[model samples]
Target: MSDAQELAALLAQLPDAELAGVVGAATEGRAGLAALHAVARSLADTLGHAPDVIDVTPDTLPVAGYSQSETVGGSGQVGAGPVAPGIPVPPAGIPTAPSIGGYSSAGVPTFESVRDKVEQRYGTSQGMGELDRQTPVGRSVEEQWEARAEAARERLDQIRKSMQGNDSE
Candidate 1:
């Protein structure tokens, strides 16, 4: 089961008094977790990198027929229909940004290209580029395990020393 599920299960086993304490502690923990998540998300946005490689060939120009790249894996289907010479119209309310086709049709990036640029602009950071989940979440199980192991070792050493002291007493 997930950590969240396990946590919930443990919480369910608590009595009323203990449950209240747990709930209070959980509330505080959630607040801190939310703050950390926000920071991590913001950092990922700022530091995340997107590969920029749009085909700017004249044959692929929106005017000639090819559409700009939209989705992440899409190379952009060169529309068989005719294209106009004017600045391509994006959805209403979107900026009149310059067009990005083979011919550089003014003011219309494929949704993916636009996403890339936007990702570039405001940005997500992936914690020094270590295992950035595609969903822009935080560290992985390995990292969490490493951190927990270190803390556990420290606590175990302390307990061992305390037991030794009691034995001597």
Candidate 2:
């Protein structure tokens, strides 16, 4: 037999759980490294040459010379840091916080809606793939997805209500 057919036969012999586990482990291992490699490649392409070194350490970056004493909860109070001489500070009355009330509740609905749709669609389906149809493994996977989606929806609702309450006060 050809190498491809031999490998396919071996894969076909593996139990569904074992096959799924192997695929999941391989994907998880590659994802993080793949992201870092892609970012490095993009940066190299942008710079027109591969950099000899990439420094991610915060202290190595250029910024106004503010002493450690001026940092939050340092000698200075929070949001009261004193910039070094000649470093520009914002004019009065302008907001210093990145957002009006910090992070927003906008992203929760998008993810929860997608999860809800997935759960609704897959909840009644036999399985996602031909091999999984009518199998116990398929039922278990569907149930897990449904449970996670429901929990996330509930959590998002609670957060939305809480944020609304805060806004009204």
Q: What's the CA RMSD for each of the models?
A: 26.1, 23.7
- Cα error, residue 134 of model 1, in Å, equals 10
Task: State how far residue 34 of model 2 sits from its true place (Å).
Answer: 35
lDDT score, candidate 1: 0.50
At residue 119, what lDDT does model 1 achieve?
76
Off by over 4 Å in 2: 1-128
Expressed as tens digits, the lDDT of each residue in 52-103 for candidate 2 is 4432123332357855554564355764665333333333432233332222
Give lDDT tens digits, candidate 1, residues 37-115. 4554444344542113212123423434543432223334455334433433433322332442422444334677767
TM-score per model over all chains: 0.19, 0.25
lDDT of 2 at 12: 83
RMSD of 2: 23.7
- Please list the residue runs of candidate 1 whose C-alpha ends up more than 4 Å from where it truly belongs after superposition: 1-139
Cα miss at 70, model 2 (Å)? 81
Question: Pick by lDDT: which candidate is best?
Answer: 2
**Candidate 1 vs. true structure, TM-score:** 0.19
Indicate the residue-level lDDT of 145 in model 2: 96
